[model samples]
Target: MSLFDDYHPLKGKMFQILKPDGTLHPNMKPLLSDQEIFNLYQKMVFIRLADQKALMLQRQGRMGTYAPIWGQEACQVGSGSVLQKGDWVFPAFRELGASLMMGVPLKTVYLYWMGNEEGSRAPNGINMMPVSIPVGTHPLHAVGTAWAAKLKGDKIVTISYFGDGATSKGDFHEAMNLAGVFKVPTIFFCQNNQFAISVPRKIQTASETIAQKAVAYGVDGIQVDGNDLFAVYAVTKEAVAKARSGGGATLIEGVTYRFGPHTTADDPTKYRREEDIEPWKALDPMVRLRFFLKGRGLWSDEVEKQVTEEAQQEIDQVVKEAEAVPTPSVEDIFKYVYAEMTPQLKEQMEYLKGTL
Candidate 1:
């Protein structure tokens, strides 16, 4: 049976294959080759370190406030790794790992948080959109892109990454409605990390499961164990395939938690407790996945040491490259607002330059 059918939202099912201890489920199998699993594991480790580095950069006053995807690596990598060439990803601001998985350079990711507009440009042929910082708005853009692609007869699927907070926004609902009516090939991937900044998930909506919200839009939906790499991979891969084959949209709620503060500007301790996060520490996506790999003889302490050192070296270089880029010119601030700058904007730009 398909993942969606097997774990229907109303059935209140949450799909999972790997237990917190790295043990596999009796009947379910991972949808990855041994080599593929190892590759993804490496990617996850790199991302985890990169995430910590971003936090450090922010704390050191080198970068601006940043969102930490500390504990959501599986949700990002598993879903991103499955997309084929030509598929597009629309990321909310927190999707640093997912963007990298989708082929965005680590330098660009750093540049974005470093306040460079040049960072907005993804490489040609990689259709990832610029980060949408506004809460819950990019779902509409994703659906629109998907609709346009469908109209143009392009065989590409589009996926949008959002948090649980996004579900409370009107854009999410509107996008779901449109995707359903038109049967556009898109995936609404909600990384439901249990909080929208300081607000808990329960306060955002009364819905028992975010996936069940898909029922209102007449689309397929499922809740998966966001920490389980195998489960996330299985669900996302199936959803992508279904959408690619003209099966319309699917809403996937990956139930996970963020082990850090929501962003550099926010503190979780003010609202939640260490006790709350203690349990999830055991369920860390990295820990279980690492355990699974070690059991298969694909990973070891030496391997981890090497990977971490290599990741640190690579990320350190990316930081240098990002910082080396020239700062934006004064004109850059006023030039992109319109095809031609208005006299008012021109006057403001000139006034600012005069002051500088």
Candidate 2:
């Protein structure tokens, strides 16, 4: 039997640390300390509140269409927290939690969603790419960067975040193949939220699991309970260490779920039944983490109240700062496309300027 037979990446058996009831498995305890776990829990709660606040902002016309990271907090926060300062992160649109953990300001995130281009700019020295709206394309950028880092003898790992639907794209397959062959230090983090917009995972591909696809490229892959913060953190830490040690790339399939619509513009009720969401709700990452902390006497009603109030204050300030920025001019849209505008673009810019 293959060595991986017992693990069965194709079986949909997720590697979990915390059970649905917020209890840890006897043999699967995380390496994190009480303080570390408490800090992680605080970050998760903050991200969840920020996500909800973004939704409310959208409804109130304070923001453009927003992508909700309502249910994938653990996957993003755990993986993001494992990275060092030198590592690079390439995020898909829904990675607000990860970006926030990576030092992307809440105000910047809000500005991006509120249709400001400056929000896309990462602070100097922070190794994050602008959010990629195109599915699966940024993995190539990550792989290329990883390859360059490897060539330069830099011990840096690059992580690319995408949804399960991205696995079906040719760009994803090509990036995986190239990374595997070149032994590039890249981590392909796929949050398998069970749906690609309206299409369920069943229709996205024939592969039993997204992680299993890595086998074809001769790269290591694993499926973890995306809702289990400990599991996500453990697997991601292992992947980053291996990458730093020249073990090539890893594909991590985080089996997660999106509790809300794909975006503010897309309605889940049109395609999914309400019953399908209940089971996932019971396995909420924040709730399970909260339970673990409460059981350990590390959490209390007062702590909850304090954290909630602090998070609200922070998010309120972010919104205020984001809204205070002056609106972009019509000409601003034409500015970032090129260093020097092509004749055709210049003509178009001139025409638009005259119209304005």
Candidate 3:
């Protein structure tokens, strides 16, 4: 018998419920009700608008550099929709949709990009860490938090979100290994958007799939079509259930695409061809979901108009609030970096203050 005789046949296949043409797989219908699906659609539209508004703000010099989540809304919203109130989320910088779903206000997200420390603060009783700009480091933090929760007999599970590039980091491997060994209730959610900035996914790893990395760590892994909201929701819901039931850890690789430049500072056209992106445009998650809803009579132009108008108004208010907040002092940056200021830091702060 071959060494792979017992291997899972579906390991490399992308789990998909909604097909790209807006039809559902006959046997893989989503468990969500019509109203629930509508609600999810509304949330997706809201975040897409917010994301576009942020990009515009950055261009207008109203905000600092931003990472746009244009094409990956379903990946974030679908997975994030499954979280319970008490669960924790650790997000890399691109997870604005996930943060928003977890009760981080629009104004706070805007405030964060505008360089305010207050934007990082999660509301009381909300379990979300500030955005981790250092790539793969937060997975370790998520694992640690989950391990602590396990030790304390708390039922909460933690989910860590990172990009395709993060999988190459030592911290990612260490966290995965530790989480598996300890059997902590953690979900390692990787949104494989095909590029780590200008670097393509194929060059990022020699492995056939990012999800298969879980095999070495002895954790369960699944690959989902991140553009299919139904598939993303189903996989994440199953993972969350398993974690709560002491099933150790799981890794989910969401195969999606980023439709914009990596960030405000980067130009994607130099690295990616227009023809390469044209195919993914046909697979846009929002368009697919809208078609599904329309076929079921749950969506229409009027509904789309209403949702768009409402979201734009809400975003307008959030932009106003964010801009009204005063710019953070230079000391604000140094203050949040330490629990109690070290002597060296104190001296540096004094010198900086003197210079000001």
Please identify model 3 stretches exceeding 4 Å from their true place: 1-10, 339-343, 350-356
| Model 1 agreement with the true structure over 1-356: per-residue lDDT tens digits | 77788899999989999988777988887989889999999999999999999999999999998999999999999999999889899999889888998899999889889888878889898888999999889989889999999999998999999999999999999999999999999999999999998899998899999999999999999999999999999999899889888999999999999998989999789999999999999999999988898889988999999999999999999888888999888888899999999999999999999998
Off by over 4 Å in 2: 1-12, 354-356
Predicted structure with the largest TM-score when compared to the true one: 1
lDDT of 2 by residue, 68-119 (tens): 9999999999999999998999999999998998898988888899998999
> What C-alpha lDDT, on a 0 to 100 scale, does residue 225 get in candidate 3?
91
- RMSD in Å for all candidates: 1.0, 1.8, 2.8
Model 1 clash tally, residue pairs = 0
User: What is the C-alpha local distance difference test score of candidate 1?
Assistant: 0.92
Ranking by lDDT: 1, 2, 3
lDDT (0 to 1) per candidate: 0.92, 0.91, 0.91
Worst 10 residues of 2 by lDDT: 1-10
Q: Which pairs clash in model 1?
A: none
TM-score of each candidate structure, all chains considered together: 0.98, 0.96, 0.95
Deviation from native of the Cα of residue 3 in model 3, angstroms:
22
